[model samples]
Target: MLRADGIHRVAVEDPGSLGARQHLRHCGLDTPPVPVDTDGVRVDELRATGAPAVLLTPAHQFPTGVVLGGERRRELMRWARAGGLIIEDDYDAEHRYDRPPVPALRSMLPEHVCYAGSVSKLLAPALRVGWMLAPPAYRDALVAAKRFTDLGNAALPQLVLAHLMESGELERHLRQVRRRHRRRRDAMIRAIRAHLPGAVAHGAAAGLHLTVTFDGDFADAGLARAALAQGVKTQPLSWHSQRPGRPGLVLGYAASTPTDIAEGIALIGEALRRLGP
Candidate 1:
């Protein structure tokens, strides 16, 4: 849709989703890195990029997990209203634990914001179904693009998802998972404190995973490899960053049991110890 709309330059959140950056590049878009701070993507830096459009994960930012702040949201709205487009990927808004519901940029200015979300994070990625809301000017082009792409998503899954949504079964499922995921998240936090004392966890208020950054120059890839050799999986923080940043890991607790979460962290701690200072 963006290509059809003549938007070529997009400011992406740095240390954001590596997959997203790859996707933008593959789609032939010029992506400039926009730094993300604790409050979320730095709007001042975003403006500095001079890109007409920006793609970001505002609700629960990927890798780091900071929600875009209120003032930044207002500033973003103003920017969008003044001809900039906002591509809001509300990927894990439903997975929130410690906070009240947050609003999407699309909600504030549908005319300027293009909202995209999927059941992948909410339910299952196997469903291979998601949705997009575009401004009136782009809606038809969006539909045409979909038709040209895969002839639209399969019918059965959409019908089933629609049924689950209309019958409120999906919400019930989300409620159940949220409670379950919270327990696992707590377990992970406890394990991190106990096993990896030098680590500081981030984005724990929402999402399936949290990031833990170490103080000094760190060897996160070595840590991840060591854990992997011991049957534990981990992602290095640098994999997602366009620039040099702290050494850290992105660990997921969504599918693991509390016991498993503890054991994994313990293994990670053991690995860190072996690669001594």
Candidate 2:
């Protein structure tokens, strides 16, 4: 869509959606990192960049997990109104365990937001099924792009998913997974408190992953490497950052049992301690 719209420079959240960054770069678009705070992507910073388009994970921001505050949402809409484009990646908007559900930014302003989502998190990435809602201006072009890109996804799986959706089987599966994911999230929080005091956890209120930031100086990459050596895998927060920032780790709890979650966090704590005071 960006290429079709002739938008070559795009603004993305710093420490934001890595997948979006990868996609944009692959398409040869220049992506400038705009800072994201408690309220979400800093529109002021985005405006300063003078980029015509931006990719956002507003509902549950990637890595950070902070929802875009209401006022910021309004600000973003205003930006879109001023001819700026919004690429809303509605990733993992389904698995909320705490607080009220946040509405998708695309819901508020469909004309300016290109919303994309997949069943990758819900069902399985192997299915390779997803959908996008593009504005009228980009719809035809996007369809052409999809057609040229491997003639679109397999129709058999898409038809099967449609059947699951129509029969309400998908919702039933979601309810079951939500319960399990919430338990794993809680276990990770408890383990963080028990084994890694002083480490602050973010995005715990929702989403499948939690990001924990720590004070003082420590190489988060080194910590991740140490944890991997002990058979626990983690993504260093720096991997997502375009600029220098605090040391942290982004850990996903959805696929593991509570016992495994606890053990993984404990291993991370051990790795952190070994990294020194």
Candidate 3:
């Protein structure tokens, strides 16, 4: 919709989401940094941007598992109420292990939030089937964007997804993945505890991945590159941050078995160890 409306400026979380910002920039949009706290995107900073729209993953914040606290929810509401657009990315809302499912912000402020969800993490990224619920104002334009982009997704996959949704199979599969993902989450947490004592883990209460930060002086990007060279791929926390911050890594456990998870964490431990005395 940014393309259709010619809206060039967007507000994103600082020390958050560099890939997203780069994607926007690739499309000729300027993404300004907004600070996010334990609550969520700092509304005051977001408001200060004066941008017309913002993107967020409110249910389970990206790179950090913290849920948007209630007070900040109201803050986000006020920001949207005051003519701000919210792009809600409900990416990993279902995999939550330590908490109840948080309701989508769009549910409360439909006209102001563009809620998006996909079966990628639930099933597999190959599914590539995602749904977006947008405000009425931008609905038509977004539909036009979808139509021109890929002709409304593949009809067969959409039909299959619809069948699963209607048959209760999708929900059942989710329950299964939820259990498996939780076990993997626990394993990763233990692996971190047993392996990387100095690293702080975040976003482990939910999602297929965990964020681990270290207090040491090594660059996260360098560590990630080293890990990659060692045959272990990880996303550097710095890769997501727009502002300077502590070094860290984002590790996915869903696709790997517990044995692999331990090995991966151990490998990361070895990599970090190689960086120091």
lDDT top scorer: 1
Superposition error at 89 for model 2 (Å): 0.3
Worst 10 residues of 1 by lDDT: 214-223
Worst 10 residues of 2 by lDDT: 15-24
In candidate 1, the residue pairs with backbone N, CA or C atoms under 3 Å apart (3 or more residues apart, or in different chains) clash, namely none
RMSD of 1: 1.1
Writing each residue's lDDT as its tens digit, candidate 3 over 92-140 gives 8988887789889998999989888988887667868988898898878
What are the models' TM-scores?
0.97, 0.97, 0.95
Which is better, 1 or 3, measured by TM-score?
Answer: 1
Clashing pairs in 3: 65-203
- Model 2, span 213-232: residue lDDT tens: 99988789998999999999
Off by over 4 Å in 1: none
Q: Candidate 2's C-alpha lDDT?
A: 0.90
lDDT of 1 at 230: 90
Q: lDDT-based ranking, best first?
A: 1, 2, 3
